[model samples]
Target: MIHTISALVKNRPGVLAEMAGRFGSSQVNIRSISCGETENPEVSRMVISVEADDDAVTAITSDMESLDVVIQVDDLGRKEFVDRELVLAKLTMDRETTTQLMQIFEVFRAHVVGMGQETITVELSGDQERVDGFIQMVAPFGIRSLCRSGRIALKRGDD
Candidate 1:
Protein backbone atom coordinates (compact mmCIF):
# COMPACT_ATOMS: atom_id res chain seq x y z
CA MET A 1 0.00 0.00 0.00
CA ILE A 2 1.03 3.57 -0.56
CA HIS A 3 1.28 5.60 2.62
CA THR A 4 1.38 9.35 3.14
CA ILE A 5 3.40 10.46 6.14
CA SER A 6 3.68 14.05 7.28
CA ALA A 7 6.48 15.22 9.49
CA LEU A 8 6.83 18.56 11.24
CA VAL A 9 10.46 19.42 11.74
CA LYS A 10 12.67 22.31 12.79
CA ASN A 11 13.45 24.49 9.80
CA ARG A 12 17.18 24.39 9.24
CA PRO A 13 19.78 23.44 6.73
CA GLY A 14 20.57 19.71 6.54
CA VAL A 15 17.28 18.86 8.23
CA LEU A 16 15.97 17.41 4.96
CA ALA A 17 19.08 15.36 4.43
CA GLU A 18 18.95 14.13 8.00
CA MET A 19 15.35 12.98 7.57
CA ALA A 20 16.19 11.31 4.29
CA GLY A 21 19.15 9.54 5.90
CA ARG A 22 16.95 8.28 8.68
CA PHE A 23 14.58 6.75 6.19
CA GLY A 24 17.46 5.33 4.22
CA SER A 25 19.04 3.74 7.27
CA SER A 26 15.73 2.17 8.17
CA GLN A 27 15.44 0.59 4.69
CA VAL A 28 12.38 2.62 3.84
CA ASN A 29 12.20 3.75 0.22
CA ILE A 30 10.42 7.04 -0.11
CA ARG A 31 8.36 7.27 -3.27
CA SER A 32 8.12 11.05 -3.06
CA ILE A 33 8.86 13.84 -0.59
CA SER A 34 8.04 17.54 -0.45
CA CYS A 35 8.78 20.03 2.32
CA GLY A 36 7.78 23.63 2.76
CA GLU A 37 7.45 26.30 5.41
CA THR A 38 4.24 26.26 7.36
CA GLU A 39 2.46 28.86 9.46
CA ASN A 40 5.24 28.71 12.05
CA PRO A 41 8.41 30.01 10.46
CA GLU A 42 10.57 27.89 12.70
CA VAL A 43 9.07 24.66 11.49
CA SER A 44 8.52 22.98 8.12
CA ARG A 45 6.12 20.32 7.01
CA MET A 46 7.43 17.35 5.04
CA VAL A 47 5.00 15.17 3.17
CA ILE A 48 6.38 11.80 2.16
CA SER A 49 4.88 8.92 0.28
CA VAL A 50 6.08 5.34 0.45
CA GLU A 51 4.88 1.97 -0.63
CA ALA A 52 5.26 -0.55 2.15
CA ASP A 53 3.58 -3.28 4.06
CA ASP A 54 2.05 -2.79 7.47
CA ASP A 55 5.21 -3.78 9.29
CA ALA A 56 7.31 -1.52 7.15
CA VAL A 57 4.93 1.35 7.75
CA THR A 58 5.21 0.89 11.50
CA ALA A 59 8.98 0.74 11.32
CA ILE A 60 9.25 3.80 9.12
CA THR A 61 6.90 5.80 11.32
CA SER A 62 8.81 4.85 14.45
CA ASP A 63 12.09 5.70 12.83
CA MET A 64 10.88 9.13 11.76
CA GLU A 65 9.43 9.89 15.19
CA SER A 66 12.76 9.07 16.86
CA LEU A 67 14.53 11.85 14.98
CA ASP A 68 15.36 14.91 17.06
CA VAL A 69 14.51 17.35 14.28
CA VAL A 70 11.08 15.84 13.80
CA ILE A 71 8.54 17.45 16.10
CA GLN A 72 5.64 15.23 15.06
CA VAL A 73 4.68 12.57 12.52
CA ASP A 74 1.29 11.72 11.19
CA ASP A 75 0.24 8.79 9.00
CA LEU A 76 -2.34 10.20 6.60
CA GLY A 77 -2.71 7.15 4.40
CA ARG A 78 -5.85 5.98 6.08
CA LYS A 79 -7.14 9.42 6.87
CA GLU A 80 -9.18 11.68 4.66
CA PHE A 81 -6.76 13.95 2.88
CA VAL A 82 -6.48 16.05 -0.25
CA ASP A 83 -3.39 15.54 -2.35
CA ARG A 84 -2.11 17.16 -5.53
CA GLU A 85 0.83 17.23 -7.93
CA LEU A 86 1.85 19.80 -10.51
CA VAL A 87 3.12 18.85 -13.93
CA LEU A 88 4.54 20.98 -16.71
CA ALA A 89 4.86 19.56 -20.17
CA LYS A 90 6.42 21.07 -23.26
CA LEU A 91 5.07 19.57 -26.47
CA THR A 92 6.05 19.81 -30.10
CA MET A 93 3.19 21.13 -32.16
CA ASP A 94 2.19 22.47 -35.54
CA ARG A 95 -0.38 24.98 -36.64
CA GLU A 96 -2.58 22.18 -37.92
CA THR A 97 -2.89 20.61 -34.49
CA THR A 98 -3.16 23.79 -32.44
CA THR A 99 -6.92 23.72 -32.30
CA GLN A 100 -7.02 20.02 -31.51
CA LEU A 101 -4.42 20.46 -28.76
CA MET A 102 -6.36 23.31 -27.24
CA GLN A 103 -9.48 21.17 -27.22
CA ILE A 104 -7.62 18.38 -25.47
CA PHE A 105 -6.31 20.86 -22.92
CA GLU A 106 -9.80 22.11 -22.28
CA VAL A 107 -11.04 18.57 -21.79
CA PHE A 108 -8.34 17.96 -19.20
CA ARG A 109 -8.73 21.37 -17.57
CA ALA A 110 -5.09 22.13 -18.29
CA HIS A 111 -4.00 25.44 -19.76
CA VAL A 112 -1.28 26.52 -22.10
CA VAL A 113 1.24 28.39 -20.01
CA GLY A 114 3.63 29.25 -22.81
CA MET A 115 3.78 29.12 -26.55
CA GLY A 116 6.71 29.02 -28.94
CA GLN A 117 6.95 28.78 -32.70
CA GLU A 118 6.99 24.98 -32.56
CA THR A 119 6.32 24.11 -28.93
CA ILE A 120 3.64 24.67 -26.32
CA THR A 121 4.14 24.49 -22.56
CA VAL A 122 1.19 23.42 -20.51
CA GLU A 123 0.72 23.28 -16.77
CA LEU A 124 -1.67 21.09 -14.81
CA SER A 125 -2.22 20.54 -11.12
CA GLY A 126 -4.34 17.66 -9.96
CA ASP A 127 -4.38 14.39 -8.14
CA GLN A 128 -2.10 11.64 -9.40
CA GLU A 129 -4.75 9.94 -11.48
CA ARG A 130 -5.79 13.09 -13.29
CA VAL A 131 -2.23 14.10 -13.99
CA ASP A 132 -1.35 10.69 -15.32
CA GLY A 133 -4.38 10.67 -17.55
CA PHE A 134 -3.44 14.02 -19.02
CA ILE A 135 0.08 12.89 -19.77
CA GLN A 136 -1.13 9.74 -21.51
CA MET A 137 -3.58 11.69 -23.62
CA VAL A 138 -0.99 14.26 -24.63
CA ALA A 139 1.80 11.84 -25.46
CA PRO A 140 0.96 11.72 -29.15
CA PHE A 141 1.69 15.42 -29.41
CA GLY A 142 5.43 14.68 -28.96
CA ILE A 143 6.49 15.78 -25.52
CA ARG A 144 9.88 17.48 -25.49
CA SER A 145 10.29 18.16 -21.78
CA LEU A 146 8.36 17.48 -18.64
CA CYS A 147 8.67 18.26 -14.97
CA ARG A 148 6.56 17.31 -11.99
CA SER A 149 6.42 18.31 -8.38
CA GLY A 150 6.37 15.76 -5.63
CA ARG A 151 2.95 15.01 -4.30
CA ILE A 152 1.80 17.14 -1.39
CA ALA A 153 -1.17 16.47 0.86
CA LEU A 154 -3.08 17.75 3.84
CA LYS A 155 -5.53 15.97 6.04
CA ARG A 156 -9.16 16.74 5.33
CA GLY A 157 -11.48 18.64 7.61
CA ASP A 158 -10.89 21.10 10.46
CA ASP A 159 -8.06 20.53 12.83
Candidate 2:
Protein backbone atom coordinates (compact mmCIF):
# COMPACT_ATOMS: atom_id res chain seq x y z
CA MET A 1 0.00 0.00 0.00
CA ILE A 2 1.03 3.58 -0.63
CA HIS A 3 0.61 6.03 2.23
CA THR A 4 0.69 9.78 1.96
CA ILE A 5 2.14 11.55 4.97
CA SER A 6 1.79 15.27 5.45
CA ALA A 7 4.21 16.92 7.80
CA LEU A 8 4.50 20.50 8.96
CA VAL A 9 7.98 21.40 10.17
CA LYS A 10 9.97 24.45 11.16
CA ASN A 11 11.37 26.45 8.26
CA ARG A 12 14.96 26.06 9.33
CA PRO A 13 18.05 24.93 7.55
CA GLY A 14 18.81 21.19 7.55
CA VAL A 15 15.25 20.29 8.58
CA LEU A 16 14.60 18.45 5.33
CA ALA A 17 17.86 16.62 5.52
CA GLU A 18 17.18 15.61 9.09
CA MET A 19 13.71 14.31 8.23
CA ALA A 20 15.07 12.40 5.21
CA GLY A 21 17.74 10.83 7.37
CA ARG A 22 15.11 9.71 9.84
CA PHE A 23 13.04 8.14 7.12
CA GLY A 24 16.13 6.43 5.76
CA SER A 25 16.99 5.05 9.18
CA SER A 26 13.48 3.68 9.48
CA GLN A 27 13.93 1.88 6.15
CA VAL A 28 10.98 3.71 4.63
CA ASN A 29 11.31 4.24 0.91
CA ILE A 30 9.95 7.58 -0.16
CA ARG A 31 8.03 7.30 -3.40
CA SER A 32 7.63 11.03 -3.85
CA ILE A 33 8.08 14.10 -1.68
CA SER A 34 7.17 17.74 -2.22
CA CYS A 35 7.94 20.48 0.32
CA GLY A 36 7.53 24.24 0.40
CA GLU A 37 6.82 27.09 2.73
CA THR A 38 3.30 27.43 4.01
CA GLU A 39 1.24 30.55 4.64
CA ASN A 40 3.32 31.05 7.76
CA PRO A 41 6.85 31.75 6.64
CA GLU A 42 8.23 30.11 9.74
CA VAL A 43 6.71 26.76 8.76
CA SER A 44 6.85 24.46 5.78
CA ARG A 45 4.62 21.59 4.72
CA MET A 46 5.93 18.34 3.26
CA VAL A 47 3.76 15.84 1.43
CA ILE A 48 5.49 12.49 1.19
CA SER A 49 4.31 9.28 -0.37
CA VAL A 50 5.76 5.96 0.68
CA GLU A 51 5.04 2.39 -0.21
CA ALA A 52 4.64 0.53 3.05
CA ASP A 53 2.23 -1.59 5.01
CA ASP A 54 -0.12 -0.12 7.62
CA ASP A 55 2.13 -1.13 10.47
CA ALA A 56 5.13 0.48 8.84
CA VAL A 57 3.15 3.63 8.19
CA THR A 58 2.17 3.87 11.86
CA ALA A 59 5.76 3.47 12.94
CA ILE A 60 6.96 6.03 10.39
CA THR A 61 4.43 8.58 11.58
CA SER A 62 5.35 8.02 15.17
CA ASP A 63 9.00 8.44 14.36
CA MET A 64 8.30 11.65 12.44
CA GLU A 65 6.26 13.04 15.31
CA SER A 66 9.19 12.47 17.63
CA LEU A 67 11.35 14.87 15.68
CA ASP A 68 11.83 18.30 17.28
CA VAL A 69 11.68 20.03 13.93
CA VAL A 70 8.38 18.36 13.06
CA ILE A 71 5.42 20.43 14.15
CA GLN A 72 2.70 18.05 13.01
CA VAL A 73 2.27 14.81 11.08
CA ASP A 74 -0.85 13.38 9.51
CA ASP A 75 -1.51 10.17 7.60
CA LEU A 76 -3.48 11.68 4.77
CA GLY A 77 -3.87 8.37 3.00
CA ARG A 78 -6.55 7.39 5.49
CA LYS A 79 -8.37 10.69 5.19
CA GLU A 80 -10.34 12.52 2.58
CA PHE A 81 -7.89 14.74 0.71
CA VAL A 82 -7.28 16.39 -2.61
CA ASP A 83 -4.10 15.61 -4.48
CA ARG A 84 -2.68 16.72 -7.76
CA GLU A 85 0.41 16.52 -9.98
CA LEU A 86 1.66 18.70 -12.77
CA VAL A 87 3.21 17.48 -16.01
CA LEU A 88 4.91 19.39 -18.80
CA ALA A 89 5.55 17.58 -22.05
CA LYS A 90 7.27 18.71 -25.19
CA LEU A 91 6.03 16.73 -28.21
CA THR A 92 7.11 16.59 -31.78
CA MET A 93 4.66 18.46 -33.97
CA ASP A 94 4.15 18.94 -37.66
CA ARG A 95 1.43 20.29 -39.94
CA GLU A 96 -0.22 16.89 -40.29
CA THR A 97 -0.08 16.18 -36.56
CA THR A 98 -0.95 19.73 -35.39
CA THR A 99 -4.68 19.23 -35.78
CA GLN A 100 -4.64 15.84 -34.11
CA LEU A 101 -2.45 17.07 -31.28
CA MET A 102 -4.62 20.11 -30.73
CA GLN A 103 -7.67 17.90 -30.44
CA ILE A 104 -5.92 15.63 -27.99
CA PHE A 105 -4.73 18.58 -25.92
CA GLU A 106 -8.22 20.07 -25.88
CA VAL A 107 -9.66 16.77 -24.71
CA PHE A 108 -7.12 16.62 -21.94
CA ARG A 109 -7.61 20.31 -21.03
CA ALA A 110 -3.91 20.93 -21.55
CA HIS A 111 -2.55 24.29 -22.65
CA VAL A 112 0.17 25.01 -25.11
CA VAL A 113 2.86 26.83 -23.21
CA GLY A 114 5.44 27.11 -25.94
CA MET A 115 6.00 26.32 -29.57
CA GLY A 116 9.19 25.61 -31.46
CA GLN A 117 9.87 24.86 -35.11
CA GLU A 118 9.11 21.16 -34.63
CA THR A 119 7.96 20.84 -31.05
CA ILE A 120 5.09 22.02 -28.89
CA THR A 121 5.26 22.30 -25.14
CA VAL A 122 2.09 21.66 -23.14
CA GLU A 123 1.24 21.81 -19.46
CA LEU A 124 -1.34 19.80 -17.53
CA SER A 125 -2.20 19.64 -13.86
CA GLY A 126 -4.65 17.13 -12.43
CA ASP A 127 -5.03 13.95 -10.48
CA GLN A 128 -2.56 11.15 -11.20
CA GLU A 129 -4.93 9.22 -13.43
CA ARG A 130 -5.69 12.23 -15.58
CA VAL A 131 -2.06 13.19 -15.83
CA ASP A 132 -1.11 9.65 -16.80
CA GLY A 133 -3.86 9.54 -19.40
CA PHE A 134 -2.62 12.74 -20.96
CA ILE A 135 0.90 11.44 -21.09
CA GLN A 136 -0.22 8.19 -22.67
CA MET A 137 -2.15 10.05 -25.34
CA VAL A 138 0.80 12.23 -26.24
CA ALA A 139 3.44 9.54 -26.25
CA PRO A 140 2.39 8.38 -29.69
CA PHE A 141 3.21 11.82 -31.02
CA GLY A 142 6.82 11.37 -30.01
CA ILE A 143 7.66 13.08 -26.72
CA ARG A 144 10.78 15.24 -26.85
CA SER A 145 10.87 15.92 -23.14
CA LEU A 146 8.72 15.56 -20.05
CA CYS A 147 8.71 16.76 -16.44
CA ARG A 148 6.39 15.89 -13.57
CA SER A 149 5.89 17.47 -10.17
CA GLY A 150 5.48 14.95 -7.39
CA ARG A 151 2.13 14.50 -5.71
CA ILE A 152 0.97 17.26 -3.36
CA ALA A 153 -2.15 16.92 -1.21
CA LEU A 154 -4.24 18.56 1.50
CA LYS A 155 -6.92 17.10 3.70
CA ARG A 156 -10.54 18.06 3.19
CA GLY A 157 -12.87 19.98 5.53
CA ASP A 158 -11.91 22.33 8.34
CA ASP A 159 -9.05 20.76 10.23
Which candidate gets the maximum lDDT versus the true structure? 2
Tens-digit lDDT string for candidate 2 (24-101): 888889888889999999999998989889998898889889888999999998899999999999999999999999
The TM-score obtained by model 2 is 0.95
State residue 136's C-alpha deviation in candidate 1, in Å: 0.5
lDDT of 1 by residue, 25-133 (tens): 8787888899999999999999998887878888877987987888999899878999999999999999898888899899989988999999999999999999999
Off by over 4 Å in 2: none
Clashes of each: 0, 0
Question: What is the C-alpha local distance difference test score of each model?
Answer: 0.90, 0.93
Model 1 TM-score on a 0 to 1 scale: 0.95
Best by TM-score: 2
After TM-score superposition, what is the CA distance of residue 57 in candidate 2 from its true location, in Å? 1.3
- By summed lDDT, the worst window of 10 consecutive residues in model 2 runs over 17-26
Q: In angstroms, what RMSD does candidate 2 have relative to the true structure?
A: 1.1
C-alpha RMSD by candidate, in order: 1.1, 1.1
